[model samples]
Target: MKLMHVDASPKGAKSNSRMLSGQFVEMLRERIPALSVDYLDLAQDPPPHVSGDFARAIYTPEEERTPQMRALLEPSDAMCRRVLAADALLFAMPMYNWSMPSSFKAFLDLIVRGGVTYIAGPDGYAGQLARHKVLFLTTRGADLRDGSPFAGMDALTPALTHGFGFIGVRDPWFVDAQPLQFAQPEERAAGLARAQAELAMVADRWAADVMSEAA
Candidate 1:
């Protein structure tokens, strides 16, 4: 199996979400020895936003696209191709103002193309890609769980879940490193500890499942 691991945080190694995702990937590798992993670090090289010409080119028939249009469309095409090639996707994103980083949003725009990830058909909409498993790891500065003051304020999770679902990914696993901006050191420590424990649990579950399937 091939797994596409995408890290969208600009903090590099200091990113909590990246650490969580790395741990999960390690677990997957441990259980599924034959699995191949591809990593995409958006912070190092952010994808360009889609331009008007690119949109026009994608909507226009292939045979009629001008040279300028073709150039504009090439990057998005390549991004979508990479996404289509993967069997599973792992996104490590940090919540920025309750939403995903702009870099990650730009990457999403490049991949969600017509005739590539999804298509409009007689049935309304259909996803061209067959992959269904997605694992999302996020870090938030403030708590946003159910019934909390910030409840329903998690814009990134739902947005990403819907976006991936639009492209045929339905089985999504979400893990969060929450409330990083606690007023007390102990609160921050507690949050990090909880997140670590959750990561360990998720990794163990994933490992067990992979081994079971292999056996």
Candidate 2:
């Protein structure tokens, strides 16, 4: 199977999402020895924001697309094609101001192309590219657990889910690495330990599921 792994953290080596994503990729490799993985680091080369020309390219039919319009849309088309070719997607997102980073948002804007990923149909907007699974790993500095005063859910999760689902990715898994900020060293360590343990459990479950499916 082919997996597209996207690293959205700008912190480089210091990113918790990067660390966790590395572990997850390693675990996936162990589970599927022949798995093909493609890594895309958004922080290194972020896609440009959508422009008027790009918008025109998306709305215009292929027969009517001008050379200038196609040039403006080529990057986004390539990005969306990569996503469409993959069987699964792994997103390593770090929480920035209770949402996704600008790099991730930029990537999203590129992939959600009109007519390619979704279309304006009689029944409203319909997602045309909807045949993949996604694993979203998010790292946050503070707790957002249910019922806590600071427990507001990150907007990124819902936004991404809806966007991807609109184009056909319905099975989405979320792995949250949270509460990295703390007053004491001990508290920070404890939180990290908990996240590590949870990661292990998730890996085990994924391995078992893959094995069962293979059988």
Alpha-carbon local distance difference test for all models: 0.82, 0.81
With a 3 Å backbone cut-off (N, CA, C), the pairs that clash in candidate 2 are 129-167, 130-167, 130-168
Candidate 1 lDDT tens digits, 1-215: 68889999899778888887888888777767877888999999899877776667888977888898878888888888888888778888889988999999999988888777998889977886655457788888888878779987888888988887888777688888777775477776777778778767766776676667678
Reference-based TM-score of each model? 0.90, 0.89
lDDT of 2 by residue, 1-215 (tens): 68899999888989889998998888878877867888999988888987777777788998898898888888888998899888778898888888888889889889887778888888888776565667888887877878756687678778878867877777778888767774366765776677777767766766676678789
Quick one: best TM-score, which candidate? 1
What TM-score quantifies how close candidate 1 is to the native fold?
0.90
List ranges where model 2 is wrong by over 4 Å.
Answer: 205-215
lDDT, residue 28, model 1: 79
Highest lDDT among the candidates is held by which one? 1
lDDT of 2 at 76: 85
